[model samples]
Target: MKRNALYAGFFAILSLPVFSADRKPNVLLIVADDLGYGELGIQGYNKDIPTPNIDSIASNGTRFTSGYVSGPYCSPTRAALLTGKYQQRFGHEFNPGPPVAGNEPIGLSLAETTIGDRFRKAGYATGWFGKSHLGNTPEYHPLSRGFDEFYGFLGGAHSYVNAGAESNNPVLRGREIVKDPGYLTEAFAREASAFIERKKDEPWFVYLPFNAVHAPLEVTEKYEKRFSSITDTKRRHFAGLLSSLDDAVGSVLGKIRELKLEEDTLVIFIADNGGPTAQTTSSNGPLRGFKSQTYEGGVRVPFAIQWKGKLPAAKVDDRPVIQIDLLPTALAAAGVEAEADWKLDGVNLLPYIRGEKTEAPHDALYWRFGQQLAIRKGDWKLVKGPEANAARGGTAGKASTAGAQLYNLADDIGEVNDLASKNPEKFKELAAQWDAWNAQLVDPKWLPNRRAGARNRNSAENSAAPASKWKSGDSFEDDQAPQIASRAFTISARVDAAAPSGVILSQGGPQQGYSLHVKDGKLALSVRVAKQLSTVVSTEVLPAGSHQVEAGIAPDGGVTLKVDGKTTGEGKLASLIQKQPGEGLHVGNDGDAAVGEYTAPANFSGSVAEASVTLQ
Candidate 1:
C-alpha cells in the first residue's frame, strides 16, 4: 500500500500542468526566417538592430547562448521542431523544390505526427501563420497536416507586400486565397492576437513563423524611418525589416499581457537558421561561415523562452539546446507525458528550466544536411562540410572527405583550429556517434536540383551560384523560368571563344526548350515546342576575340538573336513553350538530352563571363 501510494503521487506530480490550476497554458511559438546569430541587440554584438520585444522573452525568462536549430536551413528545422525528431529520421533533409503538378513526393512525410496534431488531440485549438515550406500540394497543405487554422504561403516564401494573383506562391486563409493581405508581419500579428483573444477560455497553440529578414528585402516607410541614421543601403533595409519584426512580436506580446495571459502563456522565440550574409547583410557575429555551410554561423541562432511566474526570469543558460526541444517541452508543459513509442529526439526542458534538473537538455545534438554532417557532444564538435570553402588547403568543400575534423568549441568558437590530428581518439569517438545516428535515418523523400541543401526563398538562384555563374559544364534547375509561354525574357552572355563552335546556354530537351550556341562558326538560336523546331543561324560568320550574344523571347512567339549589338537572325514560331522546361538550365554545355541539333556534351571551349574581355 505504501509503494502504490508513492508511485501514484509521483505520476500525479509529473503529469500536473505547469500553470495555474484552472486550465492548460497557451503556447505561442514565434519563428523568424533566416535570422542571424549576432543580429539582435540582446546578442551583445548588434547594437544597430534593436529587438526589444524579442529580447523581452530573455529578460522575462531564460536565454540560451548556444541555441541551435536541427538543420542549417528552413524546412528541415521546421520538420524537426514539429515532429520532435531529427528531420533526417524520416528523410525531410532538403527543401522540396517548387510545387509542380505531378511531383507528389515534395513534402513532409505523412507518417510522422506533428505538434499541431498532438495539441489538437489534447483538446487545444491550434493555428499556424506564415511560411509553410513542407509542401504545397493539396495533400501536404497545413489543413491536411493537422493544422486547424493556416494563413500563410505554402511555398518557402512569398512577397511580403504583394498579395497578388500572379505570384507562384499565394497567401492563403484556410483553403481560400487572401488577395488583400496588408503588410505580412503586421497581418500575422493581428491574426494571432485575435486568435489568442477569442480562445482565451480554451487551451491554444499559435505558430507565428514570420518570413522576415530574408531576401527581396522590402518594408513600409513606418519601419524604415526608424533607421534613417544608418547609411549603408542594404544594412539600412535590413534594420527596417528587423524593426518591423520586433514590432510585430511586441503586438503579440502586448495582446497576451492585455488578456492577463502572461503567466498562462508559454512564449518561445527562435530563428529558422543563421543568416545568409552574402545575400542579405544579416550578420552571424563572432561565428564563421554563412547560411548554406555547416559552420556555427549557419546552424546557431538566437533562442529565448518565457513563461512568467513559472520559469525563472533574467536567466542565461549557456548549455546548448535546439529547436527540436520545443515540441516535447510544449507537450510536457501541457501535462501530457510523451509516449515511449514516439522515438522523439528532443527532451522535455521544463525540468531543466525550473532548476529541477542541472544537466544540459541535450547531451549531444546531431545534423545531416545532404553531404554535410555535424555532431556536437558537450563543447566538442565533429563536423565535415564546406567549412573548407573558407580558404584552407587540401580541406576540400566535400563533406564526405573520408574523415571529419574535430573542434573543442569551448576554446575555438570560430572553428579555425582543426584538432582532428591532435586528438584522434576524440575525433573517432564523435565520428562513430554521428555514424550511428546517420544509420537510423532514412533516405530523403525528395532531392533538390543539387545536394547544396539551400535554405533560402530564392534557392534556385542562391544554390545555383558559383556552379552556374557563367561556368562550363554546370546545370541548374530553373523552376518557372521566365522564358516560358507568354512571359517575355532575355538571355544574355559575354564569351571569349578559343573556337566558336559549341553550346553556350541550353535548357529543356528535344520535346520543348530553348538554346543558344555557336553553330557553323556563327551564333544560332533554337526554340523547340512540342517537337516543332525553329532554328535561326546568324547571317555573318567567323571568329571572335570578345563577343556579346543575346537571345530575346517575345510573348507573341517571336524569337530574335543578336550578336555584338547586330541583329543576327529573327524567326516567328507558332507558340513558345507553355509550361516550365522539365530539364535544368545548362551554362556552357547541353546536359544529356539536348534541345539543340548537337551531340551530347557540346561543351563551350572558351570562357563565358560577365567581363572576360580586355582591349590591348
Candidate 2:
C-alpha cells in the first residue's frame, strides 16, 4: 500500500503542467541574406519604405550594434552559427558551390553537432525553413542534421518568378520537391508561419533563413509599386525584393503575436552578412565594402533579439557578439546542459547580456576565405587577400590576387586607409595569428568561382567597385580539396539550343580509363539506345606525370580526349546514363560548367553530377 501510494504521487507530480516559468521558450532564428544594417528604419535608414516588421524585432527586444558573423561570406557564417565555433577552425570558411559539381561537400563534417541537433536532443521540435546552402549532398542535408522538418531550396540562390527555370529543383517540403506557385519569399513566410502554428504545443526551434536580397533580383508588382519613384532600375528592383522580405518578416512576427506566444518564444533577427551595396540599392550606410570581405561592412550586420517579458525591454548592447553565440545561449535558456565533451566554441551570452557577467564574451573572432584571412581583436583588424594573379601576367583578363591590407576598424570603417605601414607591428601580430589559424585548415579540394564576384545583381558597373576593377585573387580562389579526391568531377555550360553545345571538363585529371560522360532525356523508355547525346563529353586520361588534362568537343557528337595536352582516344556518343521523366541532369563541379541537357530523351538517365562512371 505504501509503495503504491508513493508511485501514484510521483506520477501525479510528473503529469502536472509545468508553468511557463519552468519550460524553455521556443526559438525563432530569422536570418536575411546580404541585408544592410541601415536599410531598417530603426537602424537609421531614411528610405521611404518602412521596415516596421524588421524594426519591431528591435523595438520589442535588445538591438545589438556590434553584432558580427563568424565570416563575411554566407556558408562560413552559417557553419559557425550551426556549430557555435569559428568556421575556420573546421575548414568551412568558404561557400560550397552548386549541387551538380560543388567544389566541396554539402556540409560540416558529421563530427560537428548543429544547434538544431542540440535542440532535438533536448526534446524540442526542430524546423528549418528557407535558404539551406549548408550542403546539398544527402549526408549534409538538413534532415540528416538534427532538423525534424525542412522546407526550402537546397541550392544557394534561386529565381523568385522564373517558374520551372530550374528543373526539378523546386521549393522542397521535407525531402520531396514540391512545386510552389506563390512568390518564393512569400511562400517561405507562409510555410514558416504554418510551421509555428502547427508546432505551438511543443517547444520548437524554427530557423527561417530568407534568400531575398541575395541576387537574380525578383520582385512582385505589389513590392515594385512601392519603389516605383526610384530611378535606378537595379535599386528599384532591389527595394521591391526587400519590401517583400520585410512583409515576410512581418507575417511571422504577426503569427507569433497572434498565437500569444510572444513571452514563450525567443525571436532573433539578423542578416547572413552585410548588404552588397553594389548589387542592391540597399545601403550598408556608414559601413564600407560588402559581403565577402572581413571589414565591418561584410561581417558586421544588424542583429536583434527579443524574449518578451523575460529579457530586459528595449535595450542596446554595444559589446560584440558573433553568430556562434546563439547555440549555447539557446541551450542554456532551455535548461539543457551542454555535454562537456561537446566542446562548443561559443559562450552562453545570456548572463553577460543580462548584466550578470561583466567580462567580454570572446577574446577574438577569426575568419578564413581561401587564402584571404581576417582577425578582429578589440577594435583592431588584420585583413588580407592573396597576391593578385601571381602566375598570369597582370593583364586585364588574367586572374589577379589582391595583396594584404590591414585597418584599425575603430578609426576606419571604410577600410579606405590601409594602416599596414603605420601599424606594422600590429599588422604582423594579427597576420601571424591569422596564418597560424589558417595553417590548421585543410587545403581546399577544388577552387570554386567566388559567389560575390560572379555575374549577379551587383555588377561592377553599378557597384562601388567596378567588375573590371576586381583583381583575380580578390574574386577567385582555388576550391578546397574534396574528401573524395579520386571519385569526383564536374561539368557545366550555359546551354543555347541554337549554338554548338560542347563538352567542357571542369575538374579531375583526365577521362582515360575513367570516363566523363552525360546523357540527355529521361530513362522512362529506352535503355541501350543512344537516346539523345549531349555533345558526347569524353576525355583521355593524362599520364601519371602530367599535371593537366585537356578535353575537346568535335563537330560530330563524339568528344576528343587528351591527357597532358596529348590526344588520347575518341569514343562514339551514347546515352549511358538514364533519368526519370521529371528528373533533370547536371554534371561537373561548381560554376564554370560544360554539361548539356535534353528535356526529352527516349529513355532519361536522370541528371548525374559527379557520377562515378568507372570503366569497369
Candidate 3:
C-alpha cells in the first residue's frame, strides 16, 4: 500500500522506459452520463441523429452488444469503473452528497489505488477530461489522486449552457474556475484535443468523460437548428444533444487520427448508466425500466472499444461486460501488471478479446443503492423494487419478498415476463447470490444531498456578498439564466425605502426570464416563460423585517425553496426543466409586456444588488 516514490517525477521524465513505443498505447476513455443502450447509431438508432464519429469507433473495432456498467446510477458505477473492483468493498454504493453544499464526504477510500494512480506509477502522464463526481473535496481531487491535469466539474451534473449552473464550482481547470464560453460538451472536447496535442510526445492516459446527454436539456441554437424538421420539443432537444455529443466524439477521434495516435490510443466509449427517458427523450428501446432501478435497462448501456489496428474490427460481443473491466484492461494494455494482493474484482478482457479465453469474464455482477438491490448471475437476474411486481404500472405491493421478481434475460430482454413462480429454483439460487453480495456492502457512506439552502445565488452570496437591490420598473429577466441566481426576501421594500438606481441582476440567455409579484401581502416569485405558464411560488410570510428566499437544485436532483435559510416550499421538476436560453439580462422586466417580453409586476419592489448566479 505504499505510494510509488517514482510517481512524482514520472511526468517530467519522458525518456523513462515504461514501455517500448510499440508496446505501449495511450488510453482515451470516454463516458457519457445517463446514455442508454439503443441511443446511438451503432445500436440501430435514428438516422437523423447520426453518430458517425461514435460509430467510427464501433465500425473500426468492437461493439459490445451486452455491455453494462457495474451500477445503474452514476457514482457507484464510476467507482467500480475506476477501481476495477466492486464499490461495495469500500462502501461507495450510492451517489455522493449534494455538490453545492460540499456535504458529500463519501468518496473512494485513500486505501484503494485508482487506475490513474496505477498508470502514474508506471510513468504515464494522466489527465481527466470531464465529470469527476467520484469526490468533491480537495482530498479526493484528480490532481491529488494521480491525474496530472484535470478539467471539467466535480459534481454529478451541470447546465450545458450557463457557466453559472451548478454555481460554476463544479466546472474547473486544475483547481481554477474555467468559464469557457460555448457548449459544455464541445468545451470538454476542445480541451481534450488540446491536451492530447500537448502530450503527443509522451505516454498518456486521458479519461475523457463527457456530460453531454444528461439533464438541463440545454443545447446551442446551432445544434437545435439542425433538428428543425422535428416538431416535438423534447425529441428535438434530445436529438440536438445527441448530435452535439456525436460531434464531440468525432472531434476527439479525429484528433487521435490526425495526430497519428489512433494506432497507439486505446479508446473506450460507455455511458455512466442507463438514461432517464423522462428527462432527455433518450430511447432505451426494448429494455425495461429507466435509471434508478435494478432492471436491465437501468444497468445495461451502450459499450464499445476502439484500439485501431490491434483489436478486431466490425465485431460484436454478446458477453456481459461491466465498466469495472476498464481498469484492469487499460493496465494490461499499458503493460503494467495489476498486483495479485490487491484483490481486484475484474479480470483483463484481452485474453477473451484475443480469442484465447472462452469463459465469461465475470461470474456475477451485483448492485446496491439505497433500498434497491439486484444480481445478475449469467442469464438469471433477481431484483426487488417498490414497483417490482407491477404487471405494467401497478405496484408489486409493500411485501419485500412478495414484491421481488426474477427474469431470465436470455429469454426476455424487456423483463415483461417474470419467472419467479415458474422457475422458483433458479430464482432462489440467484436471490441467494444477491444476498451474499449485499451482505458484503457497508451501509451507504452518505445519504443523498437534501439540505436546505438558498438556490439561484452565488455560493459567495450564501455567506456574505452584496446586499439585495430591488427596484420598480426594473427587469429580473436575467434571473432565469441557468447559472444566474436571484435571491428573494420576505420583507417588503418598506415603501419608504430608497430604490436602487440600476438593475442588480444580470440575465444572460434570451429565454431566461423571471418575475416578482405581490398580491394581498404575499410575495410571489416565478420563472417566466415565453409561451408556457411561468412556475410561481409564494414566499413565506415576511416577519415585519428583511428575510431571504431562494430555490435551486436539492441534493437528490429535486428543486427546493428556502426563506431565510428555512425550508418554505419544494417541488420535483420533470427532467426537462432547464434554464431558458438567452444573451440579454433583464433586471425587473423587458419594459414590454408582449409575448416573450418580460412584464414588470406592479408591486412596489425594494433595492436589489450583488445578485449573481453560479454553477457547482
Candidate 4:
C-alpha cells in the first residue's frame, strides 16, 4: 500500500539480470464480460467476492478509476476496442442477434483495421480466444480481422459447461466446431497459456476475452461451494462464476511469471461493459443503469494496465480513459505507429503516463446507444434520453428532459442531481457538442429487434387467467404472456412430429428465454437466463406420430422435461429468466430472437394441436 515505494521497487526490479530485451514487448489484453465495478475486492465495493488474481493486476500496475467502454453493450464495445475508433462511425452498432438470412455482412466493417492487424503486420503472433460477438460470418471472423489464431465462439454468448454440437453457439477452434473442453473459462485460459508458452521467444499479441459472469448463471460445484456463505442463491452463483474467471486470470498470469515474460509483456485487464445487475444480481455499486443504456454502470468498467518493470505500480489513475485507447497504447508498446489514414479515435497513453507529457490523454469522451447519447468534458457531463433518469431506476420511456440533463461527475459519481436547469449554458454546450459528434457518425447498419407492444403498466398485478393456448405459427405479444411474481411455470404442448427439428414453443430473445424444441429427433427443453443455459434433453427420440411434451420449472429453479407424462430429463437453474424477452412467445417458431443458441424462427414444421402455458 506504500504507493511511491512500491512504484520505485517495481522500477528497481526492472534492472534485474532477467531484464535483457531489445525486442518489442508482447501485448496481452484480457476482457471480462458484463463485469461490475463493485465485483472486485480491491475496488472496495464488494467484500465478499474475492478476486485476488484480478486485483493483482492493479497491485502490479496502474488501475484506471474512471475507465470506460465506447458502447454500453457487447459487440459495439468490441468493434470500437479493435478498431480504435467509435463503432458508430462505421455503423457497427447494436448486437447482431442470431443471424438473419440476408444480413450477411453484419459485423465490424472490413474497411476498418483492427489492433490485431497492426500487431500482425509488425510480425507479432496474434491470437484471439473467447467471445467474438462482433460477427458470426467467415469474413468477420477473428482470422479475417488480423488475428492469426482464433479459438472461441462467433456469437455473443455460449454455454460454459456444455459447448458442443447441441449448443446454440458452439465453441470453435480456428473456425471448426470442437467438442466441449471442460469449463469454457478454463479452456480459454489453457489455450492462452499454451500460446504464451509456444511464442515465448517471439513477440505476441493475445486477446483473451472471457464471457464469464455474464448470464445463464451456471457454475459447477467446484466453484459454487466457494460461496456457500452467500445465502442469496443468485449472487452466490455469480460469485462462483466471478471466482472461476479470477482463477482463469491467475492461470494466464502464472504462465507469464513462470516463463519470465512479465517484464517484457504489457498486460491489460478490462470488461466489455458494466454488469446487468437486475437479471444476474451483478452489483455495479452506486453506478446507475445496467447494460444497453448510456449510464455510468452500463459503460464504465474496471480497467488496469501492467507492464512489470515499465509502468508505475500500485497507482490509481482517475483520468477518464476509454477502451479505444488500448489499441494505440498497445501499438505504441509494440513499436508500431498507426498511420493517419486509419483515423484512430484513441490516444497512446505511454507518453502521458511516463511524465513525458503533462496534459490529459483525451480532452473529452463520448457515447451513443440508440436514442441515448452522452458527452463528458472534464468533470461536467451531459446525458440525453433515458440515461438521465436511469440511476433512479426509472423506465427508459419516462418523460425526457427534452434537451439534456447535466451533472458534475466528479462531485456526483452516482449521477443523482441534475444541474442542467441550474446551469443552462454548460448543458447547452455539452449537448451541442454531442450533436456535432453525432452528425459525423453513420446510421446503424442494423437495429436490434426491439420488444413489441406497449409496456405493461400493471406488471405487478397478476391477472386471473389460468392458462393461454396457441396453435401452429401462432405468436403472442410480450404482454400476452402470463405474468407471475415467481419464476415457477409450466408449459405443455401436444405436437405431431412432421420434421426432424424445430421449435415448438419459445419465449424471450438471445439474452434470455426458454424453449421446448426438437433437435435431431430429440425433444429438448432449454431455459436461458442471460448467457447461462440449462437444457434437458429427452433420453428417447419422439415417435413419428403425435406426442405430449411438457416442460416445467419449479420455484427452486429445477427444470423437468416430460414426454407423455414420463420425466425424460432434469436439470437446475441458479437464476430465473428475469429479463423480459424483447420478442414474445411463439407457438411454432422462436420469432425474431432465439431463446437459446438455436437460430431464430426455427419454426416447427408440424402442427401444434394444443399448447398451454401455466404459471405455477
Comparing 3 with 4 on TM-score, the higher-scoring candidate is 4
Tell me the deviation in Å of residue 143 in model 3.
0.8
Which candidate would rank higher by lDDT, 1 or 4?
Answer: 4
Candidate 1 vs candidate 3: which has greater lDDT?
1
When summed lDDT is taken over every stretch of 10 residues in candidate 3, the lowest stretch is 390-399
Using lDDT, give the best candidate's number. Answer: 4
Give stretches of model 2 more than 4 Å off: 1-21, 98-105, 385-403, 449-616
lDDT of 2: 0.61
lDDT of 3 by residue, 352-400 (tens): 7777888888898877654566777888788765254223211111123
Q: Work out the TM-score per prediction.
A: 0.72, 0.69, 0.72, 0.75
Model 3 deviation from the true structure expressed as Cα RMSD, one decimal place: 12.7
**Candidate 1 Cα RMSD (Å):** 14.4
Q: For every model in order, what is the number of clashing pairs?
A: 0, 48, 44, 4
lDDT of 4 by residue, 1-616 (tens): 6999999999988754343447889999999998987789888899998899999999999899899999988999999999999998987766763122344367888888888888999989999999998876789989999998998988676657766422335788997888857888999999999998888878899999998977757789988899999998778988999999999999999999988889889999999988877657777888887777677888889999999889989988888999999999999998887679889999998876666877778888998765677888889888764534333222223223356678899999988998989998887788777778878887666544322222333544323122445676455545445553346888899987544467888877666778889877888888777667777788878777788889888888888888899988787878667766554677777754567666445656567758977876
Q: Assess candidate 2 and give its TM-score to the true structure.
A: 0.69
Clashing pairs in 1: none
Q: Is candidate 1 or candidate 4 better by TM-score?
A: 4
- Relative to the true structure, how large is the alpha-carbon lDDT of every model? 0.77, 0.61, 0.66, 0.79
